[model samples]
Target: MNIREYRAFFLDTLSKAYDAAEAESLFYICLEELKGWKKVDLAMNSNAELDRVELVKWNEVLTQLEQERPIQYIFGNAHFYGLEFFVDENTLIPRPETEELVEWIINENKGKKDIKILDIGTGSGCIAITLAKNLPQAKVYAIDVSKDALAKARGNAVRNEADVTFIEKDILVADSLPESFDVIVSNPPYVRNLEKQEIKNNVLQYEPHLALFVDDNDPLLFYRKIAKLGDRSLTGNGKIYFEINQYLGPQTVTMLQEEGYKNVILKKDIYGNDRMVSCDV
Candidate 1:
């Protein structure tokens, strides 16, 4: 089949499962990946013919997209903070909002010397690896409860050429972090059970629930535990950051304030949702 013919079919079929914009975006992504053809190339060579093998590959991608599989998962990597990290069902795909949390941390602490940073519930090591890559003088450590998740995170650290220590430990059951940190950050499981309906089928079916949900009775479970751990684990003047649930922003800030953290700030993401909270211990 020719490139132009397949492009029409791809968008027309995929749009049944995804919105028009998303379907179009996926079309170009696949075009580049399969044909090494950029948008300009596609425009100039719309009549380029696809061989039998290339056609098979495109059909496979189309089938997966129709099933609502995340394009990142289908491609085996996700772009975050200008780096690509491997992702699987064991890890939640990195979100842009979490990039804002990472940006805030880097902007706040980039000038300090020989600082230590710990990322709790590090899924794909996106936050930790990005920080290590950006702040060369900082020591970065990341911990995850799932060994499978940690394996992928460690590979991502190496893949990105960032120095990061990965540990397999459940923060909720741990006594304290291995060492005091200049900064502690987490994008932990904060979505309440009641909010499950708000999640899309693509996420609810494919993403790891272990990294996504909190019980209805204790939506702040990880936040509370991490805050308490930060009490002893954080250095004086140290700060803690969290990518919080949008609906629970004020409540999260209040909880941190009640925990004796100072400078509790609830910040919004690009979408104007209160998505990040940071405080000093």
Candidate 2:
């Protein structure tokens, strides 16, 4: 079919699954992914017919999108912290809020050299690799419980050309984390069971739950564990960062203070949600 027809099909089919504006956006994204054509090219060559092979691939992606699968997963890649990383169902897609958290860590530790950084529960290695790329002088390590996720993370490290050490270990059950870390950051499981209904279907259906959830009775379980680990593992003036649940910001801050973390600060994301917290050991 022609480019205009394909674009219309994208918007029409995706509209059934997504909002109008979002469907429109995904159309452009998928168009680029399928044809390597910019929007300008599509607009200028509106009536140009797509070759059968290209049409087939575009149809496959459209079918997946109609099924409510995330576009990033369909494309097998995502952008975060100004870098691209491979993604699959094994890894939670790197998010914009997490980018903000990375930016915060980079800004907080700018000009530091030869420092050690550990990323707990590093699903896609986005946090660790971005830090290593930006702070070229720092040593970066990432850990994940899932072997599959670690494999993908390792591949992502290579794809991004950022040197990072990856480990497969469940932090929740680990004896101890990497020691003497100048910075420790985790965007661990924080979604409570009680909040499951609030999750979008695309996420609940496709994203891995191990990286997304915690028990409602103990919603801050990962945070508490990571903070305690940081208390024991962080170096002098070591800092701990977390992308926390908005509802539990105060309690997370309290937990950090109780764990003997000083200078505890909870910061909001662009959306004004209490999404990040940091403290020094």
Candidate 3:
């Protein structure tokens, strides 16, 4: 089919499952990924034809989208904090809110030198690696419980040329770090398992459960554990940052303060919802 006909067909197929804007965005995303063509390129050349082999591959992606697969997973990569990183079912897709947390850290320490940062549950290494790249003098370390997740994180570090130490360790059992850090951050699993019904099928069915869900009875399990770790792991004037559950912001801040972290601050995302917290040791 020609570019115009193919675009219309693809949009119509996805319109039933997604909004017009989303469908169009996905169309352009897939087009660029598959053929190195943008919306403008297609608009300028309406009669452009797809190669038979490329057409088949594009159809497979369309089928997955119709089945509610996340586009990021389908593409096998995503952009976060101005860098591209590999992603898969084993890792949680990096969210924009987490990018704000990274921004906060970067802005707060813009001129600081030789800082040490630790990222817990570093899926895809977005947080730690971004920090290392943005702050060239910073020493960054990331830890994850899953070997599969750590492997992807390591790949991201290599791809981004961001020097980071990846460690295979569980934060739940740790009382102190091997050494103190200047700043510690985490975007841990804070989604309550009971809230699964509220999650979209695209995420519930495809994303890693270990990186997304927490026990419903104690949704703050990771918060408590990581807060305790920060208490022991942070340097005397170190700061702890987290991408928190919006619904449990108050409780998250309470956990940090109760754990002896001072200057705790809860900040909202661009949408003006409670989304992140930072505390001083």
- Using alpha carbons, what is the TM-score of model 1? 0.99
Q: Compare candidates 1 and 2 on lDDT and give the better one.
A: 1
Model 1 off-target regions past 4 Å? none
Model 3 superposed RMSD (Cα): 1.0
lDDT of 3 by residue, 21-67 (tens): 98999998998998888778888998988779878998899999999
Q: How much lDDT does candidate 2 score?
A: 0.89
lDDT against the true structure, per candidate, is 0.93, 0.89, 0.90
- Tell me the tens digit of each residue's lDDT in model 1 across 1-281: 89999999999998778889989999988877778889999999989898999989999999999999998888898999899999999999999999999999999987799999999999999999999999999999999999999999999988999999999898889997899899999999989999999999899999999999999898999999999999998999899999999999888988999999998988999999999999999
Which candidate number maximizes TM-score? 1
Cα deviation of 57 in candidate 3 (Å)?
Answer: 1.1
Model 2: ten consecutive residues of lowest lDDT: 171-180
Q: What is candidate 2's lDDT per residue for 1-281, written digit by digit as tens?
A: 88898788778877777999999889889878877888898889999998988888888988998898999899899999889989999899998999999999998888987799999999988999999899898999998999989998899889889999998888888778856799998999999988989998889999999999899889988888888777778888799889999999999998888888899999999999999999989
Off by over 4 Å in 2: none
